[model samples]
Target: MLVPLTRQSFEQLIPVIATSSQYAYYWGKFPDFLKRLLISVVAVVVILLLKFLLGDGFDPLLFLLGIIAGLYWFWSPVYWASRRNIEIRRYKYSGFWQGRVLDVFVTEELIGTEENVNNRGELVIVENRERRLNVEVGDESGFTTLLQVPLRRTHKGIVPGQIAQMVVMSNQPDLSRIANKSDIYIPRLNIWVSDYPYVQRTVFSQVSRQLTQAEEDDYPANRVVKTRRRRR
Candidate 1:
């Protein structure tokens, strides 16, 4: 079950967060059951090819073993590593969520289950607090409301409790105008996102300088004062 948290809550959990590259790789690219089935077929084909080319006398048992070995090597390592990594770093370990707050506001909520194009969907029950709430959620993905993220991967810094003050759109009267939200887990073969709003652009402005490990010298304290005097 998904639990909610605040930015401060997430910050407290960052220290223990797992930073495994192997986990990140798969968690960031988890596949579905159908895809796993396809992979098994490919594995069998590969085993057959190896036996035909190298096995002077094809041993059916050996070929079967090779297929099994291939599947084992492919699935277990990727799946378990990713799952373990996330588990090690999750709130269960740290006991809270951590992240920034971008903005919070309330609109009519659309609560219902949605269907996926390829697979069955879940029953999403959203309770649009009867009273409009200035909900503070992470807006890194332009998703003000709940988003169905993938199991293996997580959109970094887009954790719950982040805030976004600026808005490109406003709440609808009936909430029926809400566009269908995308399931982040749905894999796309050739997904090409166009004109999408990236966090770097929206999160920071040209006038703002990002911080680095090495601290840079601060701007002269009198700089602003001097500028103000000059304007006068």
Candidate 2:
């Protein structure tokens, strides 16, 4: 038997059925406040300089040239430098995992239980969560690194032996092959150090250490600093 619907029943269900939409917008840009400031400063300075030199003449050509000079002085370098530093740089993607960081030291060789394998031959191990990073030299000048990251929580989402996606910037396509277990380098995910989670620093330091030891100590002029995203 169907029970008849009533107004009181519909009213009681309305509040529970309504869902508020929440929007999270990442990487929003601010209005160019500095651009306005640059325009104002250039207008004032050019007017004053022309008043001293041209003595209040109705010269539109001189005014245009002065505007161009102001733009070059104030905004051109800022715009170009920001563009080269941010838009042109390449970035790697680190994996998302449901586990806490386990800071472990990396070394030439270590003993741990087999964890899992990704499509590449990288090895996963059930080792100490409190581990230290170690960089080791591998075949053909290949590099190996150990990273220690804190595990914030425990979850079954990432089993004891599972390979997760992690990305690193590499210029050589050959380096991409190293993530496999058969390769010399192994990659891990969800690792954090000094409260900053990620492997970029550890990876760079390890590479630098290996390079220095190999007597190839030279800093590239165009090294880009890896920055962490600000948490809301």
Candidate 3:
């Protein structure tokens, strides 16, 4: 899912070009069911053939292991996320792309279920919270980029129609509107941003102190006394 980001918020908005790369790199090459079915079918066929050839000496339990391994190899979300995270860090980690905040909003939670494998690899059931963001970018253009990002991956608020900036790799600089950009070193990605505002405050206060002769040397005091009694 694409993360929601506005410069007004605490997170960064998804980079227009990077989002495309994100999907192409992260999501399953095929639909989940299709991939799972392929894994099970191929593994079962191989396991059955092996058992038949080896006689009863071979354990049928090997079929389950084969299915698990095949599924992990081809369609595991954990594996994909891990790899994608690494790629993002390596490529889009330092450089930044700045743009105006066109829009900011939240999306309905996506309800779904996936394998709830624990650290020990035990299966369980749990509801997944797939938060998403849909932000339209581009101030003036025939085409605008709609950025879809996961909320969990987002945390910034520049507000609607405000100037926003974020990190993108040097290779995909075309993704952002503004060009001639350079590397902006920041800690993380996916945030909201906006134009800075003016604030008013009182800065000075009265203070008591004693000054020595040297401290007041710049302002020399000269006094003269004159009497005009005769003129009276």
Cα lDDT tens digits for candidate 1, 1-232: 1223243443332322233444344434446545656667777777777778877576877566776855753565465654543443332211111112333233433344544453356554443322222223332334444332122212222322322221111133332233322112101111111111111222222211222111223312111111011110
TM-score of candidate 3 to 2 decimals: 0.32
Candidate 3 structure lDDT: 0.39
Q: What is the lDDT of residue 16 in candidate 2?
A: 20
Cα lDDT of candidate 1 equals 0.33
Mind giving the per-residue lDDT tens digits that candidate 3 earns over 37-115?
6766787678778888878766757666666756654455445544544444443223323334355565655478777
Higher lDDT: candidate 1 or 3?
A: 3
Better of 1 and 3 by TM-score: 3
lDDT of 2 by residue, 1-232 (tens): 0112233322222222111210001111234446645675777687768768876574676677666655653444444434432321232211111111122223222334558776798876655324233212222223333333332342112222222222223333433433311101222323222222112334433433432332222322222322222222
TM-score, predicted candidate 2 vs. hidden true structure: 0.23
Provide the overall lDDT of each model, using Cα atoms, as 2-decimal numbers. Answer: 0.33, 0.32, 0.39
Clashes within 3 Å, all models in order: 16, 26, 38
Ranking by lDDT: 3, 1, 2
After superposing candidate 2, which stretches have Cα over 4 Å from the reference?
1-43, 54-61, 65-82, 85-87, 90-168, 175-232
The worst-scoring run of ten residues by lDDT in candidate 1 lies at 223-232
Q: After superposition, how far is residue 88 of candidate 2 from its true place, in Å?
A: 3.3
